[model samples]
Target: MARTRCDRTPAWAQLQLAYDNSGKAFDLRQAFAQDAGRFEAFSQSAPYVFADLSKNRIDAATDKLLFDLARQSGLQEHRDAMFAGEKINHTEGREVWHVLLRTPPESSQDGSHRSVELAKVHETLNAMLAFAESVRSDSGITDVVNIGIGGSDLGPQMAVIALDAFATTGKRLHFVSNVDGHELAATLKTVKADSTLFLIASKTFTTIETMTNARSAKAWFEAQGGTDTARHFAALTTNVAAANAFGITTTFGFWDWVGGRYSLWSAIGLPLAIAIGAQGFREFLAGAHAMDEHFRTAPLEQNLPVRLGLLDLWYRNFHGFTSRSIAPYHSALRRLPAYLQQLEMESNGKRVDAEGAALPFGTSPVLWGEPGTNGQHAYFQMLHQGTDVVPLEFVAVKKPRHALASHHTLLLANVLAQAQALMVGKVDAGGHKHFPGNRPSTFLLLDDLTPASLGALIALQEHRVFVSGSLWGINSFDQWGVELGKVLAKDVEARLGSGDTTGLDGSTAGLLARLRA
Candidate 1:
């Protein structure tokens, strides 16, 4: 039972056969014109998500071969290994269990594997939620500022703004991630020192940018005659001793199994909890938990994450497509592209396997895009006529969160039109007007972008990452890549302060001189 890559599988040969014989290229126009059931056959509904993959260049035989590839690749074994709490992240000897962070206490059957971890997950979650509720109800707390970088800053900040309409609490939320003094200065100008609460978010309480920003924020607060330091600042770091030494009384800890990119379900989601309150936050977790169960138990052919990941492998390995575009139609979900950029690129952007052997194949693709209509104006032209074949992923909501009906209709129309246009291209008589007709795209429709739906959507992405990582045989959880730069930056920062560039790279020395000047 040696694990196999998709290319080594027998199904890969079948896929190649189908791909070769399926004409010069599988044309979506021809497929739709020939089969009346094209849309119905390609579209699928699972939980809160519905995907319309009809616009893609794939055919019936393509899907069959892809499913066979999934079976032959041992995708099920890799998936189950993760769910069983095996050390799938072999590079760090850690279990990849961000999924467990969202699993509800009641849903875990009495003797299930998840039930064993349920007690600790809920214990921290409950304490964190209680703290969030307390902050929400506090009339003295007019503003909450979160100091973090990467996953710590992105997920909570994005969700809080996305769910602003659902926020009953009137408190304003601010996130400071940059080392630049201007960001903190601008934020501090708007809030009274006595009325603001700052959440210092770093897993180790030692991330240079986070700690620097936290210290600057504290300095500003103290200089402004703020008396109560303990009440005003809390921490979301596992390093309780560091937080205590810094004079913070409250702290929340997450397990090592939770990677920074996948930490939103852990205490990193404290800002979301503060924004939406305890009940809404719990609904978010429950939604993710439901998707976790679905991912863990669903058959490969029927599984949404599995299907999507298999498609990813097909595109990357077989078709040689390099990047995939994510277009979320709703304006509220604008940050989703950025959030996923970190989640996918940071997780699976590895050149080595879990055993640290250099891989012969590609890992994660470069994920970059803005919200729809916006991207339609910006990059859709390149996608329509660009030399490279970039697969598009469109996320559309069935219902609008906003009250503006006209805007929603126009948005939906643009979304539908884009996918339609991608499949059915226009060819004019003139040479410049000849549009290519075989570009591919995937459409994901959500019932709505409620906390529950968003949770499910994000969880689906997490599992998709898992599938791709498993197939690549890489440790997706540990981010050793992010560390080297941090280490280098410290040396550079000291050189910048002291005008010393002894024994540095040519580029580093030159950059140092320019900065010093």
Candidate 2:
């Protein structure tokens, strides 16, 4: 695979021209007042997603330039290559095909050939769902301990909590991601081994944090006289041999093409499949597949992920925005920011291109935020009155999943009002009352928080990450940066036991002493 850097084109030059001229002073209020059709012109619908981009600081010329930038950057070609199973992930020498994982069995051209892989996906999903169903129905098994980190823990944990209503299974889900033994110890105190099922989620069955936790859980289970090892312990890992060696007979596997963050559609989503059941899990895949089809077939001008990615490029490269705040209004989506933090940061947080050449331009921006009302009480002040002009992405749901009518109305109102407040601030004649009303924000409205809609939303985010990473000419799949920490941690752990300050940094020595003391 040849690694090509996206060259600045005529469209980028035109964008520079536009940015110098009228686009620099693009104001949302003035644009809205000047154009009655601003909202309709800017807002677009795709499947379960509706975007109100009129709240953003962009005009038609801005969008045209963005589209041009996309063209010049060869975004369409990159996107096409990914869908066509080309090795876009140049560093990994593999095709990025998490989308293919969610593709239904019947949708494949040859079911027999595809059956092995497709059946594995469905089989694990089915088994996990059966386990979740049994646990849900059983009054005895009240606690589920998910021992995994990063993608394994975040995706399922987030979705299970979000769709709490659909979870009539009555099992409390506990996710243990940190390597801290205290976390595992705390979880162990609440449930007995007989009542708890530990889902050890690791793609390689060798992640240090995951394996450490799994071993500790197993030790605790055995020490506590937990007899049903096969019944209580299940491994969500591709390395069946390693899992079996670890005394885990029940195991599930996913392919190399599935990145950890994108593995929820594979067996890595066992926890989610267990919590939501086979049908709901299928709906989740179908939701993502719907967005997949849309992304594959939609025009560049009308594409949601493309448009968002283009805006991301414009903000990061041209407008000089450093970070993005993701504010999901629904409490269920409280973890959306963390999920995206990994999705965007891990993918595009690279200093080098595919060929290991240092990049001249910026790649991924720092992404951070909490849920809406909570964030409003906490960091929304910084967002509104902070020194930086951080762009905010507010995700709101049109309909509520629960019957709490008043709470839903208040949530929607707060979301809408927050966007409006950001755009049209209260004017004050006094010095302290002065308000900067031109803060830009984008509102993404979903019809409901169903499994399918969640899948679509997540897939949309995945593709957007792909767009930015592709345009930046970086490999989004591989995570070489994560290794340095692991290596350093080993040295630190040894130093901690030895109390040796020799050849260690002053800060490290001090921290080690403090920890030991």
Candidate 3:
């Protein structure tokens, strides 16, 4: 599919005019008062997620123009290209086939003609799951530590923690992602070498932070008289030779089609597989696959991802909102904010379009948040009455995994009330008690936070990001921004060891000297 930047479209100009005419003064309160069916008109129900977008500053006219913008930008064709196995990740020359990882083996038989890739996907999946089950059944290994960074860490860590109720009862999962020694050190203090199984996760088995942690773990294992290297250690990487050399006889591989940000469905999810076991892991994948099908077949008007993505673009380009706050109400979903931060920021944080041309407008907004109620006390103040207008996305679960009805009811009440309060502020005689109404928020409700629901929810987020990026003309699959830091860090590390600040800038040189001293 040929790339078309959104700003270059006629719909973009029309949308701008549309915004100028009535979009700027879009009052959520007035819209509700004027339209009796405003809530039902904007709300949508998908496989496992329900979204209420009536609270957002948008209406029927805005929706039509936004859908027009999506059409003008060739979003439909672009989405088709993705599912058709074309290399939409133009720069990387790889297909964005994370969907394949989630698809069941039987799906290949349905005239999809993805049998070859599907076979490979299931091969690795079966092997990885067998290994995970074996590890889970082993009573000796009580702890599993995953050493990886970025997608390697965030996706698996977040999913495992989110689905902790389904995790192996006897085992504890630990994630070490930070390059700082403190994180790994603290994790090491909790587990002995004999009882812990270390999983090294890196596509090349050569990420500096991952390898550094891997080596430290190996050193600790050897020092503690642990000898079963092959049984105790595993690698999630394509570099078989390097993993073999590292004493990892068990290794699972994935293709370049899996970008780091979108790799949770791949072998990088081994930790998640281990935690949830093979059946639960399959359910997770099945949920994501359902969402993939929805994104593939649903009409633009009814598509959840399309609607959310269009709203994101509308807020960023027209409404001039700079950030979107995510408030997942469940404590089990605490890592969701961080997971989305990397997912959205790393995927679409681009200055240049797919054709390597500079973009005239902003792409991804600053996505930030904490779990609800906790944030209500912290940054909720700024969100409620701050000078800048920031949009909020609230994710709530209708059914609780726990039996605490009182706690769950209170939690749900707080989330609903917060959304209501954001839109309907109170006017008081005292300045401190007064609140200006008409703030915008989006509420996403799930029946439960089961593996399937969480997977669908995350897939919903991933596709929405893809929609916005595709329209914006950015390669949502590639991340060149993260490369510079690694290269510079190598130079700085050499300088640190050698005490050579000769060519260093003033601040770096001073910091190096202080560190040495």
Candidate 4:
């Protein structure tokens, strides 16, 4: 079936009418007053994650229209296309099967073309995990430094830090993504050459930033009288020849189907595997696979990912909300907002649709936030009283990993209070204290912050992004938008060296001179 852009759908007009007629006047307080079952009706439980979407400004009628819009846009067909391993990434002529990366090996042995791909995925996964196990047993290495940018850095780093409780206790994990020498310099200062392991994680092994850091790290190791480069360094790249040329024999490869942002389930998760050990890594993959199955098999209305994506559309296209705030209550999950920023924006932040036609509406929202209590201090003031109606998502764990009972109680209280404050504002006679309440927020609760729960949570977000991108008629897999800057930077860097500012705009020339000096 040909993909239909959302704006052209009949339900799009119906949704607009619904918004103009009654959806715009949705008051959360009044909705609860009118319907005592609002909480149960709006909330949903998925694999390892339960969501309370009740505080969002949506009634049953609005939800029906949103569901209608999804069907009218052929979302089901697009979703199926992805699962069947069709080339849904039209711009790249590749199938998006990051789902397969987390799928169980034996279960994926069905006699299909995708089975072959799955076998290859399992082969690389087994090799990578074996290497990880070796690293875990090695007492010589004290630190592991991952050198890569974007997906290569974010997914593994975030997962490693988030699952610190499950990590093998001896190794320290450091990530160096930026091209600035200071980042590598700071990391190098922390560990001796013999005690450090460097993992170079570029798919093609030629990403400029990653290669630069890798070269500098190798130089540092040699300068420090370290021998056996192959013993200390490994490569997670498909370009085996290049990695071999760079003295890296230990390499694991993934296919073009694996996009960087969605690659933690692949060999790009080497650091995560090494940190949490092989078994813990497998549990993480299983959690994600469970979510994938849920997304593939569950009905649209009952699907958490679908429900969240539809709500995103309702907020962005109709309610005119420009950004979404992600507040993870756990301190270990502090990097979640940054990880999601890349996942959502980089995937759907497009001006044009799959056919290269300009879109009539916004695609991705500005996804930003700090950790919970910190964000409460910094931006909660604006969230509760700001003019713009940005939706907030709060992720809370039911059980605390720490032993401090009072601290956990306070943390949970603050989380619940923030959600309540957004919906039910305090009314005071004093002018400054007069708070207008009716804001929307989503509460995502996990049983605990384990590998499985974290895996399911991340997969849920990925599928939700897929749903929105599908409805928007966008190819979320390709990231051509990030390339122009790299090309421009090369020119600017040469100009900085030569002091030739020709063909540069005034702002660029001025900035270039200032940066050079």
Candidate 5:
């Protein structure tokens, strides 16, 4: 289906007019005072997550216009194209079906056209879970080291820590992604080679950072008299030939449709599966699948992802907010902002549209943040009184897993108070103490940060990103920007040893000399 770019739509003109008329000076406090049902009108419940979007700089009129923008932009059809297994990621000529990774076999069978692909998905999922179970039951394996970068590293590492309470196995899961030998070396020092199971998790088995760490890990294992590479090391990769060459027999493979940032639900989730057990892993998938169904079938007016995505556009395009701060109130979700940075930035940080045409508007907002309370001390001051209005997102869990009632109460109170303080700023006669109220924020709450809720939350973010990217008419699945840096780094690495300055720019040559010095 031919998609309409957001700026070219009739609704876009109305939105521009709306923003110019009142959106530029839109006051959250005034909006609330004027509209009695604003909170209920904006708040939405979807799957395992409930969102309070009332505090955002939007009203009923702008929301309706945004819904029209979604319709005019062909977001519904574009989203359907992805779920239908079309090669929507035209750059790579692959279907963007990370959603399929979470789909149940019975539900997947409903899409008869994708039976073959669905079969492959379940086959790999079953095998991966079986392997995870084996590792979980293995008492000898005291440590599980996952060697991968990007999706392989961030997704699994974040999930493992977030689901630490659910980990049945006593095994410590270590993720080494950075090519910096310090991270891998430090992790290796803590675990003995004999009791450690290394999972190499690059799809091609040749990601430079992953392979570098894998090679070092292998050498350390062999040096420490650790034999049985087949038992000690497994490959979560499609390249069986490369795995065999590297002395790894156990391999789990996912499809080409699964891109790196979105590969968490694929075999890349083995570390998480081992940590939380097969049942928990399945629950995680089920939770995400529920969100997927909501995104697929729900009306635009009632859709959580649609509402959030349109709000993102309202902030970025009209409000001219260049950044969004993600403050997960839970300590376990400390890495969430970092993971989302990659998920959103890498997915939609393109300068061009899907057809390679340069975009006239901004795409992704710079997503950055730390866990809350910590952020309250550090950057919360800047957020409260800063010149630029960076929209803040606060993620809070209603229930705590721990029995510390007072601590949990304090945590919940802080989250609520912070959101309130952002909106209802205290008026001070002194200029330094004055806080301009009506700062926008979106509050996301989960009943508990279990595997199911975590899965739903992550999936909600994924689809929300897709909604924005779809309207912007960009290929959300591709990350061509990251390749140029990698390609340049290879040449720089080679130049460091050879002292070859040929074709090197002045800055590169100068930096090379300084580094060598």
Candidate 6:
């Protein structure tokens, strides 16, 4: 089927009708009371993750309609086009092939998804892994600082922290993304110049914030009388000439097809690679490859990502939920919410469709949350009592790596109680104490938090975002929304120095003058 915007599909009208008739009033508590098999019907198990979607405000009939929307919207075709490397990122005129970074060397994609790139992909993969191993073995390097912004920083930082249990290299992995001098300054005080290895990550080796931090780091290295630039600094960028000019002898490069948000699986993962050993890193890739294959081969009805994406669309368009709260029950995944904020928002936060036409429906929802138990004390108050029905996603691991069984048991109990409380709330008390029942939520449980499980979870989210963007008919790979402020920043930076606010707006000009003064 040809690619079709969701609104253009016949199923779209049917969905609207369903929402008007039953969807608006569909309650999980009521649904469960009506259907004995609701949990079994709604819940599903993927490769490494099991999702209990029964608590979500969706019924079997509405789910079928959602599946119809997915089919009519040409989601399957769009997904296939991405895997085939057909320049699906039409706005940028590039293929979205970050999936290639995870594919095994022996994996046969014969006559499929541009198999010829496999040899090239593995060559870089082998080299990057070798370098990571070298870094892991180096006793002199006590700290490895990754200096990059956006995808370069968030992806690796999230993974490194998430898989902290797997990192046995006795090296501190630090990430510096902000251009704020204080952030870099604070990090500098923590590590000796000679003991630190800085990985400068920028696709072009000229990203303003990354390069700014990189230059400052270099300056500090020299200021501390540490003169060996080649030994201490490495670049994760394609601009080999620029890296060379910057006085870095070691470098790794990834393709333009790898979007910044999706580049982590590429050499952008060097920090994560160095944190976990070569074997663990490869297992990470293997885990993601397993998910990639599942996405490539699974049927629409059985596909985990498809279900999530369609449900997200339901919440955004029909149900009118404007935001989602991501509550990871594990402390180690504290960065997971921030990582997903970039992953989903940067990808689908668009005002227009792929054809440059304005879209009638909303694209991305506001996603915000902290690690659970912590969040249970914060904004979760509003979630229970507020008028707005923000959907919540609870991620919990079935097993804990730490031996604190009592703490783990308490954590698990809280996560379960939270989901249940949201769905089956108390209301017998008077108005002030009454708890409204039937708040929607999804529970994603992993058997254990390992390198492989983390890989699978991230890949699942990547594909889920893709499915939603595909149905919306937007170029999810390109982030043109992020460019406008950047361009204005350059003009404003110059004005801050010159105090020339000639054509600037009153607000900007006044603010610039005040800052300069």
Clashing pairs in model 5, backbone N/Cα/C closer than 3 A: none
TM-score of each: 0.96, 0.95, 0.98, 0.98, 0.98, 0.98
Candidate 5, 436-516: lDDT as tens digits? 978999999999899999999999999999999999999999888889999999999999998888999999999898888
Candidate 3 structure lDDT: 0.92
lDDT of residue 262 for candidate 3: 91
State the lDDT of candidate 2 residue by residue for 387-496, as single tens digits.
88889999999888778659988988999999998888767788466557788988899999999999999999999998888777888999999999899988888888
Question: Taking the tens digit of each residue's C-alpha lDDT, what string does model 6 give over 150-268?
Answer: 99999999999999999898999899999999999999999999899999999999899999999999999999999999999999999999999999999999998999999889999
User: How many residue pairs clash in each candidate at the backbone level?
Assistant: 0, 0, 0, 0, 0, 0
Q: Worst 10-residue stretch by lDDT in candidate 1?
A: 1-10
**lDDT by residue (tens digit), candidate 4, 1-517:** 5789999999999999999998898889999999999999999999999999999989998899889989989999999999889998888999999999998877646778888888998888999999999998889989999999999999999999999988855799999999999999999999999988999999999999999999999999999999999999999999999999999999999999999999999999999999998999999999999999999999999999999999999999999999999999999999999999999999999999999999889989999999979998899888887778889999999898878759988999999998888899989887577668888999999999999999999999999999999899889999999999999889888999988989989999998889889
Span of ten consecutive residues with least summed lDDT in model 3:
106-115
Q: Against the true structure, candidate 2 has what lDDT?
A: 0.84
Error of 1 at 4 (Å): 2.1
lDDT of each: 0.86, 0.84, 0.92, 0.93, 0.93, 0.92
Q: 136-247, model 3: which lDDT tens digit per residue?
A: 8999999999999999999999999899988855689999998899999999999998889999999999999999999999998999999999988999999999999999
Which whole-number lDDT from 0 to 100 does residue 176 have in model 1?
95
Candidates 1 and 3: which is better by TM-score? 3
Quickly count the clashes in candidate 1: 0
